[model samples]
Target: SPQDLTVSLIPVSGLKAGKNAPSAKIAKLVVNSTTLKEFGVRGISNNVVDSTGTAWRVAGKNTGKEIGVGLSSDSLRRSDSTEKWNGVNWMTFNSNDTLDIVLTGPAQNVTADTYPITLDVVGYQP
Candidate 1:
């Protein structure tokens, strides 16, 4: 695979803290097009939580598949007091985080010039 895939900081908002710092988990991931085909997995570090500690390939339309990279925790708590947003405070949590992805396989069956892949993040609170 070539160095064609890219990772960006997708703004995170509407975050809430659980009773404690909820552990991170990989909810789901979806890829868009063939444009993300040349990327390959390297290594992911930081505060990422790998529930299974194993990454799986998401079955796609053709030979192209979305890879499940995992998820991380971005919940922030008030330092001074127990402040809860009663539909009034619009406090959001933004982290200097990134979605690490790599391309492994080639385009399968689709014939579209460029495919647009989308990665999704889901959080679990307990």
Candidate 2:
């Protein structure tokens, strides 16, 4: 049987537009299980779109106007495949472990607005 997991994000201060701003803490993932489990996360979409479905633009005057989104986590390691979760390099957490999710703004275009992004978490129990 598969164990149930509860994940949640703790909101932090607003993110400033540009790489000069420090990374903001986006989420605190909590895994509920008696045994250890390995997990990895990836963006569900390519670009971070706003509620109006517009790609996020870089912040700055006379910028290139490119689109970008950045997400990261210190607890989770990068995986070779987005759809597959191999126990080898994935993040392993014991029962009730909390993982912090961080996001760094792109160099140029970001605004003072909220952009909702979805992430898929792949977990494996071995």
Candidate 3:
């Protein structure tokens, strides 16, 4: 079901952006599975990387000094422990029919101001 999924990145609440932040453009990204498949096999793998050899894309123009992206999770809550983490877990990507991704930057040399970024995850499966 990986083909049915999409991933994106956003700033964390405490890791917000400063004023006039340099617009961060999504750059060369590689997406692929580390599952039983070899490093560069075809079809047998999931939507690891688009044939174009890129991972993510910027959706719209700069709206402010900040931005956001969405992510998805399969097992909403792992470990089955009653406790919850105070922060989001830095996801380890796997092609186990799950969703995983990374988000980098506030654009280079963004203003020194602090801004809050939040990731709204949806379409999670288990």
Give the count of colliding residue pairs in each prediction.
12, 6, 8
What ranking of all candidate models by TM-score puts the best one first? 2, 1, 3
List the global CA lDDT of all models: 0.28, 0.45, 0.28
Runs in model 1 lying further than 4 Å from the true structure: 1-3, 20-38, 46-126
Candidates 1 and 3, the one with greater TM-score: 1
Model 2 ranges with Cα > 4 A deviation: 14-22, 47-73, 76-95, 105-109
Q: Which stretches of candidate 3 lie over 4 Å from their true place?
A: 1-107
lDDT by residue for model 3 over 1-126, one digit each (tens)?
353334333333343334323333322112334332211111111222233111223222344343332222222222121211233222322323333222323343343433333232223222
* Model 1 weakest lDDT span, ten residues long: 75-84
lDDT tens digits by residue: candidate 2, 57-102: 3332354344344344344333233232442223334445565555
lDDT at position 27, candidate 3: 20
TM-score to native of every candidate shown: 0.22, 0.51, 0.21
Residue 76 in candidate 1, Cα distance off native in Å: 26
* 2 against 3, candidate with superior lDDT: 2
Best by lDDT: 2
- Cα error, residue 32 of model 3, in Å, equals 22
Distance from true location, Cα of 91 in model 1, Å? 34
* Cα-based lDDT at residue 120, candidate 1: 28
